[model samples]
Target: MMITALANPKRFLDLSRTVSPWTCALAVILLGIGFYWSLFATPPDYQQGQSVKIMFVHVPAAWMGIFIYSMMAGASLVGLVFRHPLADVAAKSAAPLGAAFTALALLTGSLWGRPMWGTYWQWGDARLVSELILLFIYLGYIALWNAIDDPVRAAKAAAVLALVGAADVPVIHFSVDWWNTLHQPASILRLGGPTIDKAFLVPLLIMIVGYTFLFLWLLLLRMQTEILERRARSLMMARGA
Candidate 1:
């Protein structure tokens, strides 16, 4: 019910304007706390030592990359099926942000891998390959949206691609489990509780929450801009007519 009410473009714009500042503020605060804890406070791993610090950044980015794509898929579903207003806008607004996070994940993962795995990147790793494919999928979705001239047509076409690409998400998530991959399996979320100790886990959770809030802040800003731009374009068309 609340979702339906917020579906109106004007309401969405108003709400976004009101809430974006708070979201940004919260993200900044949380990220600051998270980084401080992770960098200075958390004890280094006996095994990986300082190299483990990279996980604080890389893990959150990886989580956000998948998470944002899932958000886009859900928005695309609503747009393609129930024809929810602002659904396409939400999906389109999230794409670039998702791509950035995905790229960061790969980059940080590489940085982590160099000292740990003795190589910057290994193509043979299933998890790495799947993650790479996910980045490509994000890029392809954005490209498809830009390829079409008509906004309506672009949205519809992009929705189909988003839904199809969603199938790959699970593959990426389970790649470590499904195959013999260098990437670690689910530790925090699984049958057993997190294997990581409180010293590391606490900071990691803070970073994850901060990353999530940051994405929401950016998503709202981008969606508002899109809404305003479209409204302006419509006004120009009406004036010309």
Candidate 2:
């Protein structure tokens, strides 16, 4: 009910305008503190030296990449089943952002990998391959939306694709353990608590919070932009008609 009400473009626009600045502020502050702690405050690893610092950014990005996709898929499902306009908007808004995060994860992982695994790229790794597939899924959703002329049809088709891609999130999550890959197993959120040292963990936790806020900040901006664009397009079409 609330989502449907906010689906009114004017209401959404007003809400987004009011909230965007705060989100941006939070994201910036968190990112600054996170990087400072990651680079200067965190202690070097017992094994990986300073290279382990990459995890500060990469791990959070990887988490966001998976987390955003799942959210997109869930929103897509809601749009498809409940027919909520905001749900489709949320799902559509998530695509480009999720793609960027996934790309970041892959790039940062490669940078970290070169130092740790002695290679920047690998073919047989399940986690890497699954994540790469995730990027493609995001792109495909965007493409599907653009290819269709009618917004309703586009949303339905894209929603289906997004839901299908949701299955891969689990695959990405378990890939490290399931496959004999170079990627490390889960820490922090795993059983028996985090195995990471406190010094390094603080920076990592800070970075994670930073990355999460950044995602929220970007998502709000993108969704608001999309809402405005759609409204403008609708107005233009009405005038032409």
Off by over 4 Å in 2: 123-125, 171-194
Which tens-of-lDDT digit does each residue in 164-227 have in candidate 1?
8897668665774466444444222111123788788889999999999999999999999999
TM-score of 1: 0.90
- For all predicted structures, in order, the TM-scores are 0.90, 0.88
lDDT (Cα, tens digit) per residue for candidate 2, span 1-241: 7777886768877888898888888889988998998888777777777887788878888788888988999999889998988789888988888889989989987887777666786544556667787788788889999999899899999999888778765766576446643544332221112478777777777788888888888888888887878889999999999
Q: Which consecutive 10 residues in model 1 have the weakest lDDT in total?
A: 185-194
Indicate the worst ten consecutive residues by lDDT in candidate 2: 185-194
Candidate 1 achieves a global lDDT of 0.85
For residue 224, model 1's alpha carbon misses the true position, in angstroms, by 0.6
| Candidate 2 positional error at 226, Å | 1.0
RMSD (Å) of each candidate, 1 decimal? 3.8, 3.8
Cα displacement (Å) at residue 159, model 2: 0.5
